[model samples]
Target: MADKPGNQTPNTPDVSESDLREMKVDELREEAREAGVGAVSGMKKEELVKALSEARSGSGGDGSGEGSGSEDDLGAGPDGGKIRRGPESSKSLKYSQEVTSPDEEPEREGRSLVTTHHEVIKEWAEERGGVPATVGGTEHDDHLGVLRFDFGGDDSNLRHVSWDEWFKTFDERQLNFIYQESRTDGNQSTFFRLENPGREDA
Candidate 1:
């Protein structure tokens, strides 16, 4: 049977010595970076191997080799998976809102979550380019054609929802507001909160 990542002991190396020997220096450097060993761009293969070895050992072989950065800082779950959020720097009350949690698995899956940076979307919109999307066309029902988001870049990756459907779900989720960010497709992506719009200072 194939071994699980958690099966490795601290003493056991994740990458075999033979594998490290076969990997190029660039590959070694990338491995070091993923392992969160800094200053590896100039490192030789042997140095990279040692550094990565240490990182793997120190990480207790849980498969996530992330170093000192907090999970919050990395914007990932404890398992090093991406969280459904936006960039850390975003803080606009105008876009502030809570996220609606959907079902675990739908009978029919919807579109993947939109992960493009909001800035990119805005730029695309300003350029007069819109993401190609469809709404309300299904086996059970069909509606009029394509929907585009002038300022919401690449809604192609996002599921389409009618305003009525969206508002219903939104209210059900009790989202009071919404916000967005620039870093959307990486370990660095984040979710920010906006100040309450009702505040006089806001």
Candidate 2:
């Protein structure tokens, strides 16, 4: 049987990849947290699975191993196993790369897919004076340099980084949306959809 939300017991059975696929995003995120994967609550199932799998095998999180492992090799453990991949690497991102905007904006949606247009982002940044800088290893810096998330609640501290660093980590982590909200003063917060919004495949 599937585990209930907020009731994940210590004795929960091993979750398989197929099972993980069937679970809700919140469930997948809980499982990812149990496995010590980072920034998974904001990810799609496939991306969550990949990240959890990477965490299990210690591939992407740390730069330790060499040579790519078998893709078909699902990890073996209490959690559904992860596919082993080559050593994690970083890539460059195009600051001017166009982001696909969503058809509509949902107010107060914690994580919503939005457009990745540069002009749009520039205007938003201008409102805030400059982009939020990615700070040191503080608790708020939990999301690498991609985002500023507050693990405690909805009061997420949105930070900013250079367009270069932002796009690079965005691609590396396979992210696809921005957490949206309306402050008391009637302003907005946004992030470009890093993943191809229209693609079904991971």
Model 2: how far is 6 from its true place, Å?
Answer: 62
Cα deviation of 139, candidate 2, in Å: 12
Which segments of model 2 are wrong by more than 4 Å? Answer: 1-113, 138-146, 149-161, 181-202
Find the candidate with the highest lDDT and give its number: 2
Give one digit per residue, the lDDT tens place, for model 2 in 49-103.
6665565555654221112233112121111111112233112122222223211
lDDT of 2: 0.40
- Give the range of the ten consecutive residues with the poorest summed lDDT in model 1: 102-111
lDDT on C-alpha atoms for all candidate structures:
0.37, 0.40
Provide the TM-score for each candidate, comma-separated.
0.24, 0.27
lDDT of 1: 0.37
